[model samples]
Target: METQKINVAAILVVALTGIIVTVLAASLLMAYQRVPNYGYVKSVGVGVYWDQACTENVTSIDWGILEPGSNRTQVIWIKNTGNTQVVLNMTTGNWTTPEAENYISLTWNREGQILNANQSISATLTLSVSTTITETDIVEFSFDMIITGTEQES
Candidate 1:
């Protein structure tokens, strides 16, 4: 009779342990199953920047009469007229004229810089000429630019 009682007690303990483990596993499974339904919250904002129209405001400079064998500097203004800040990016293209065929160059300021809205920045470029550039003669300068918007979550 004592042996029978001991066996019954052991069986009860084993059954309770199995039931607890099963319940825990089922709870974990349900939690994982519902994870896909959870939604995420994000904040957003609006941004504006200079468009192509801003190019019209660019300042063009001409070094009228630098003496022969002298270097001259020309400063140009770039303005940002948008709601957001922008950085100036300059790109150069090749050009050829009757007098000069292989002496054109262009450059830009540091990359990834910022320009606040309605702010203006200037760049000074130097050119070395073998002969004086006549006031009546024109030297054409052109470049491409872009105004990118700030990144904001939606």
Candidate 2:
């Protein structure tokens, strides 16, 4: 009879220990669930309206003799027609076809000094065209200009 009673006591102790462990585990899970959640927003902003304008003009090219090895200095006139100041970027190209519309190839782009608002700038466009260019050889040019708020376009 005493042995049976001790066995019952041992079983009760084990059951009580298991219940306590289960309760502790449940409590820890509840605590973990109470943590706050943090997330990031994926929306971004973009430019809506940019209203700056610029223009460039090529004034003159000093002509040279038609030979195999001749270089000439071309004078260009640049103007900023926009209300704001502008920075002019110049690109050199070769004429490939008629109508002066088609360009065969392009060279590295170059930038001129800054100009102020409503201002005009001039630079010498120096190029070493082969003397094969006669008195009426057409040179292709493309103009690109950028305007900054802090810069002047004159």
Candidate 3:
């Protein structure tokens, strides 16, 4: 009879421990399920817009005629369309014609500069042909200007 009582007490203790462990696990799960809301929207915005004659669909600049020993300049405006400030990096690709590449010179005023939100910067591009270009030589060529913007660091 004493042994039977001891067995029943041990069983009750085991049952109590199981119930405590289950309750603790359930409480922990409930705590994790409730997510705190800070009411803040998270986003990272980086964008730029070119105000040149070329649009998103059209990417070309026309220099009427390529004359030897002459320089042609075009002004392009860049605007920051993002919510934050950014620094721009500009680069140009190779000319379409390999033969005219050496004779043609391209330059921009603003290569690496900082711009604020909704701010505008004017970049002047000068295309000059060397005097060595002859009348017999074909000088029609085109190049690409790539502008990239990076978020400013704090």
Using TM-score as the measure, the top candidate is 3
Clash count, one per candidate? 0, 11, 0
- Ten contiguous residues minimizing lDDT sum, candidate 1: 42-51
**TM-score leaderboard ranking:** 3, 1, 2
- Any runs in candidate 3 off by more than 4 Å, and if so which? 1-25, 28-58, 135-138
The TM-scores, one per candidate, come to 0.36, 0.34, 0.62
lDDT measured at residue 7 in model 3 versus the true structure, 0 to 100? 100
Q: Residues 1-154, candidate 3: write the lDDT tens digits.
A: 9999999999999999999999999988884456777764423333333454324322567788977999999877777667667787766677677677678877777666887876766778888888887844655877776776677786
Higher-scoring candidate on lDDT, 1 or 2:
1
In model 3, the Cα lDDT at residue 74 comes to: 82
Name the candidate, 1 or 3, with the larger lDDT value.
3
Report RMSD (Å) for each prediction in the order shown.
10.7, 12.7, 5.5
Q: Give every collision pair in model 1.
A: none
Per-residue lDDT tens digits for candidate 2, residues 31-136, read: 4446788985432111112222223322323244434344455444445444554455545334343423232222222264555545554445444444443334
